[model samples]
Target: MSGVTDLVDPPRTRRPAITSLEVLCGLLVLAMLFQGRLAALLDVPALRTGSTIFVAVCVQAMPFLVFGVLVSGLIAAFVPPAALRRALPGRPAAAVPVAGVAGLALPGCECASVPVARRLIQQGVLPAAAFTFLLAAPAVNPVVLVSTAVAFPAEPRMVLARFLASLLTACAMGWLWARLGRAEWLAERVLRRVECHASGGSRWAAFTESARHDLVEAGGFLVLGGLASAVFNVLVPAAWMESLGGQLLLGVLVMAVLAVVLALCSEADAFVVASMPGLPLTAKLVFLVVGPAVDIKLIALQSGAFGRRFAARFAPATFLVAVGSACAVGAALLGGA
Candidate 1:
């Protein structure tokens, strides 16, 4: 009774609370949605289109965001960080192809893979292979596979082409990174900040404690990106895309660049793929393949996690490889198309 009395009512102390950026972003998005200022800066077509796209993308992305955040939180809460280290091998050469195959099992879209990849790296997985898995999984997973099959209902070859081309690209990037890249380039936080520091009882407690907050934070950002996508799609001109014209090489380059800018998730990009009219089959293929691997949102995440310099170099190189793979696959397909 005396000890209990002593334990009760300890000295009061103030602790600074960390606020999430997502809340601020979500508020700002709502503000933008209500603001009627587009008429002064742009023409009606662009305004209507962009705004419509912005709204549609945000709505469309909600389910995905929920799924992504929930899955990410689960991985954070339940799956031991040690499990990741065990799953990934140490040798880069062996890890790369293995990771490509592992992608088939992970069923989420591109957005979810980012957090999961971060977790894998924190758990001491090889960066090259982790990166490879991040690139490959969204494109190869059952959802995308089924969607690809449905989108190209006529052509089993299209599905096969998307799968094989993407798999090859992911493997190639991993091998390149393993051989030529250095781990030192990774951001200090990425190389450090592991999630398993909490002890047994504490770890379990901390997970549930943090998971709710983490889910909200991630969901908020996903909403922001989705809204941005809607804005771009609705406001921007398809004619601008048509301007890419028949220049096959140029079209591939343009689509690769757009993939970075548009930041469309891997799961929905197939529909986007079906929509683009002027892009050659090769250019469209590049769009589908490169999108999951690296995009504007991913670049931002990578910059924060792996540093801006590493992001700049790695992202562009990945883009180049994506373009090449798409061209090779496209040429083979279009030759037959």
Candidate 2:
């Protein structure tokens, strides 16, 4: 047993570092070997279209991403966790709505909300309330609202429908989680990891570190999402989408699926949906509500911040609710057209 244990736990050694020269030489070798293949791959029409979309998404989302990081940093530095605990209403029922509406104050995209929500949950805020904020922040925020309004300039009611649907979807999910969610689903260790880093530094230091770490982590996932979306946008024929548009229920379903697949930024998704003139307003509304509340990129972020179990359960639930809420709100607001 002792020998087995010794063999299993061999001494660990530090990995040798690669110098800048070594990295450059390796890059040069790889480029030299792959130059012709790389050029050929770049020339493919589908690849070119995909690359263009990827660049456009990244360029469009960067400002909002930067702003979100700044806001997240500020929250970490100045907004004490204790303050949230005290400021929240005493009951979860009351707290959820308050938190949902509180999302209006933070105009960052969904990418920024994941880290902030994790931090809030770690700070003793009710998990339900924090989750509500997580869902609502990107969807109901002023920036997103303005974008929606701009996208549907002719139909001002679209703005109202989007806001109401998004808020309802978010609040509903919070209530559902409060009733059915188990503590075991959450990755509570994420909080501990955050706290460990936060404990060693001043608020300012903690703020910078948390902000930087979150930006890097979330940004990578964002790029991956963008790439996936770009590829789909280029490969999936527009006529296929147009064919799906005529049937109301089918359109809603397809748009909801596209929302998850595209994972467009909340600030810009309205425009993307609006670009498809073939889709009905109701279907577009579904796209707007679903994109912010639940998307592939958001699922990945949630899994990182919360847990895979949580995301697996929450994403589907949120998608269903978002679709229902959008349909109901669209019918009511858009007169069943």
Candidate 3:
């Protein structure tokens, strides 16, 4: 019996690792337990302001986010990869501009564009074209343009400058990526496809699953971004705008950075920038162009969807392209004011 016991191995038990869901649940429970304390802590004016900004950002973006995921799901379920491929130009280079133009039809904000772009790539749309659509959709869509026009009623040319700059930025980034992008830059998960079935019932299942998965994944990043944006908004003094007056180069750079930090919705950003005094049209154009193309919110979304490696490279490139495009177009249209 001793010899048999020595030869036999003992059964091993492994503990399950805690997942995000478990951590989230724990946080929720803690928050519930400390609700009064949390509310009391938010009584400070700055904290209250931050909370309001956070809530506003989330509320403003949620509808667009949901719309995007649904559209992504629809694409996954109904749009055949082959059909999409056939619809675009055979050559990726030629398809890029077409994709940028196609963006005009999608009236949703930047939050809405990210998932749709990812879905397009998953559905066999050329990466260059898909990327173009991603950048162009939020900036060039009619709703955004109309809002811009309304925001700057005195400067009708602002609308045209924004459209051209955004469109150019999108196409430029697409062309650049087509030339230099490596498949390894993207995470393995982004390229992997969720299997979709051909039958009607199966398609509906696929749509719901895809939408739910995307919403769950992207929603976390969106909340994180909103928190960051609120913090920055609270900490950054509005008085800085007065100091930047008469400083063209510095104003442009600062406004560009502010656009990234603020992460304002494209449809509403025009009004925000328009409200800021002491900024030239060129600086304002940079802010308008850069906000929709790349911001902290969009950065978080890109990092979540396409891994940090891709976002690290893509975000900076898009920023520079967007700024340059805005400057060039502003020069032509706004005459640098």
Candidate 4:
């Protein structure tokens, strides 16, 4: 009976356990095997164009990313968590604007803001204030504003418009969060993750680990965003952009959406927007404001740092507020659209 049962069922086969390294190696081998075919496919004009854009965006954005991670690592390692708590105003309302203004001090890109924001929250700074800094730091920082100036050499008001719109968005979001956000919404685990890492080892070890971890995590999302932008640049019809040229409201809405999709770094988005000369300044202003505050890459980082619940609520609210802020501020500062 046993032999019959064994024969009928056959021996259960054990599958090989695959480590991540093994899986990665296997993928590399597969890629190598198809290298010739892949090269030929890539030679198609659209694909070639897309690849070029992808590489260009990645190259342009990577330095800022690296700089941001370095700053983030330094914050994690050397800056005592208590320093932030002591530095912030006791009142949440007052703290929010202060945090937003303080963002100007950090010239790093949005990639650098996530971990620093999380660190602030974990270290006893008000969540709302930390969030404001997160939004404002990338958008209003000198590096970004200067880049905007350089990109729109002819229209320098773009610099001021971007700064005001972004600062307004950050402060509004911060104040809103203070009023409505529930502490329970943010995942406790995410907050603790950074704290746990920082608690152990020497400052050097912490800095290196924080920097390395942040780079790996943020870099992947940045690359994904760059690839998406490249694909859109190549595949989205020029006619689509042209159609919205003179339609102020529609142009603003579409550019806001593009900002969310492109996820371009604050330091570099100005250049991309500059290239689209057909779009109204109001629309391009919205793009500049929205990209740094909320984008595919920023959302990913925010979700990782602040939980999906927080990110979902925060990102859309910030987007709507940003568009309104940009429109109102643009009309006033850059002349009526």
Each model's backbone clash number: 9, 0, 0, 0
Over 1-337, each residue of candidate 4 has an lDDT whose tens digit, in order, gives 8878867966779999888669889999998999999898678889888888889867877787788778778777877766767898989999999999999999888877887787677667899999999999999999998889999999989999999999999999999999999988897865563443345568789889878987887777777777888888787887788787778889988999999977777888899899986788999999999998988878877777678898889999999999999999999998855
For residue 40, model 3's alpha carbon misses the true position, in angstroms, by: 2.3
TM-score each candidate.
0.78, 0.87, 0.93, 0.87
1-337 per-residue lDDT for model 2 (tens digits): 8888977967889999998669989999998999999888689888888888899877766667667767767676767667778999978899999999999988888887887887787767888999999999999999999998988889899999999999999899889988998998887675462333244457778788778877876777777777887988897887787686568888888999999988888999888888887678899999999999998778877877688888889999999999999999999998755
Task: Choose the strongest candidate by lDDT.
Answer: 3
Cα displacement (Å) at residue 108, model 4: 1.9
Give me candidate 3's TM-score against the actual structure.
0.93
Each model's lDDT comes to 0.73, 0.84, 0.92, 0.85
Q: List the residue pairs that clash in candidate 2.
A: none
TM-score of 2: 0.87
Positional deviation of residue 259's Cα in model 3 after best superposition, in angstroms: 0.5
Determine which window of 10 residues in candidate 4 has minimal summed lDDT: 190-199
Please provide, for model 3 over 31-82, each residue's C-alpha lDDT reduced to its tens digit, 9 standing for 90 to 100.
Answer: 9999999988768999988989999988898899999999999999988888
Model 4 RMSD, rounded to 1 decimal: 4.7
